[model samples]
Target: MIFQNRSRCRENKSIFRAGNQVLQHTHEYTYLGLKLSSTGNFNLAVNELKAKAMRVFYMIKNTIRHEIPIQTWLKILQAIIEPIALYGSEIWGPLKTQDFSKWKKEAIETLHTQICKSILKVNRATPNNSCRAELGQHPLLINIQKRAVKFYQHLKRSDPSSYQAEALRCQEQNRPRSTLSQLMLKLQPDQHSTIWPNQIIQLQKLNDITYWKDATKSQKKMELYLNLKRDYKPAEYLSCVKEHKVRKTLTRYRLSAHCLAVERGRHRQRWQPRERDCVCVCVCVCVCVCVCVCVCVCVCERERERVSECPLSGCRERTAPAEVAAERERLCVCVCVCVCVCVCVCVCVCVCV
Candidate 1:
């Protein structure tokens, strides 16, 4: 038989009996300085964070009376306000927005926009997206996704059977429709083809903040260096990597002249008795090496003369002043080497024979 209304066993009014006292359930409670709702929503906590961020922003504005560099503000945001406002956000954000209630959804969106505006010093007239671009900051939504991705990368390499891993596995399998689940499913395949490695972002542990910051700075510097090198003219690169063209030509010419002299002496002694001939295995090797070097000298010198006007050799990119200087230097070297090699060879041949 069903219980009557008079039974006073209503779900809302239900009480539990302890050994000597009664315990009651409530809709809200405070845990670890954050409000916890019975329905497990964090709207109140987000609101509190937003208010605190506003207060901190004002405090920073008042503390600095002079025209301080943006770097100082950046350090404060990074060191204090950001951490305080985003303390527990990593737990809930970067997931599907559909899973959150309307209040939380609105609160998160507003929180990100307001925080961005405050930090970037942009008035309401300027577009938030443009402000983010100007400051080289990611959108609020993407920031959350970044954190989630960083955490996901860490958990992926952990022991599969451990508590955190098991929980994540379960969540992944059950929450396929979540924003993070769908995002990874869509992007994981593309990650293999990307230059960035999957494990590079696993710097999400508590103690890795300093390491991560330093690593980011280094990566940016490396990227800048690579870009500079890539766009630099081939002429500059040649100078950096190879010996001076004049020096190379001079060395080759000297060796070639010595070889020519030895060959010519052997030729002149050909009419004499075979026993008197100075030609030997060493002479033959020297002649061959001289011939090969002479041929190379001619070829390289001719190519440089032919392409003297083209600093890039074949490309159409405009040459820089440094590249022009480098080209002129190489040209001078090639001319000197070619002239030395040719004159020495002919003179040695005439003199020795």
Candidate 2:
């Protein structure tokens, strides 16, 4: 009985161990499957995060590369972080959700730390001197600094509360407003005068002269003429004018000249070659010549082949003589026609003369 009880207890323990092992294996498999299913999403998230970080880094590098102003760098940083903060609540979801709050807090903290560190890094990286001193110097930074100073000054004047405190604090700390302004004030103007003494004397003399009275009289006469011109309507006034004999003479001369030009242009246009007709004639001539040449070649080739293959020797000889005679008769007819056309042209020319 004691052996059986011990055996039973051992069996129960062994079963429990096996069951636990199976459960462990099942849990591991499930976890692994879940991870595999979400792997693509996880990788995408990581890639996006890395890309954002790279973009921010590159932006900072470029800003520094151009020797952009510290204010500009600050503005860039602010712009980057502002949206993140503004959308944090929506992005993180409700605070009641454990996953959201925890993730949001962690992300915000990490970003905040990164931005603060980046700001310090950028400030340290910027050059103390002018851009010309270094290769690949940033002009954007210089412009940003100038704009920032202007903005600060404007704010100081327009709204003391917006800028006075900051300026006073900066002054107390003995900070320089800008390097350019300091350098400009330190620079001395060239001693040489741009204008000569004689020119100055001439300008003074001209200034002393009173030409206004004569100028005023001429201006009044001009104004009166313009008023008379404006008051006269072209169609109505021309009809009303009684002494238009001189105008009529001028009008007749202009009309005759215009009519002569119009007639000359009309004659010229009538004689000019029509482009479309010329193109059509050229195309027709080319097509006719090509067709005739092809027909002549084909006929000559067939005649030669027929002569070569002729079983009867007298047949080629008889046909050749007849063909030659016919060709001679055709040429004679063409020559006679050309001579007749020349004779007719000469007779017509003699009659006209």
Judged by TM-score, which candidate is best? 1
Each candidate structure's TM-score, on Cα atoms with residue i matched to residue i, is 0.44, 0.18
For residue 341, give model 1's deviation from the true position in Å. 90
In model 1, the Cα lDDT at residue 289 comes to: 62
RMSD values, in order shown: 26.9, 32.3
Q: For candidate 1, write residues 1-353 as lDDT tens digits.
A: 12223234435555567887978766567677676666556767777877887788778788877654444555676677766666566566653352211322456556555665564443444343333322334334444546666677778779988898987887788766455566555445465553233342332222133332343344422332233332211223223323344433432232222244442354364464544334543464466567657756766675556465555656545454565557666856766676676567655654443
Where is model 1 more than 4 Å wrong at Cα? 1-14, 96-109, 115-122, 177-180, 189-353
Candidate lDDT values, in order: 0.52, 0.37
State the lDDT of candidate 2 residue by residue for 128-169, as single tens digits.
111111111111222222333343334435654656656545
**Prediction 2 global C-alpha lDDT:** 0.37
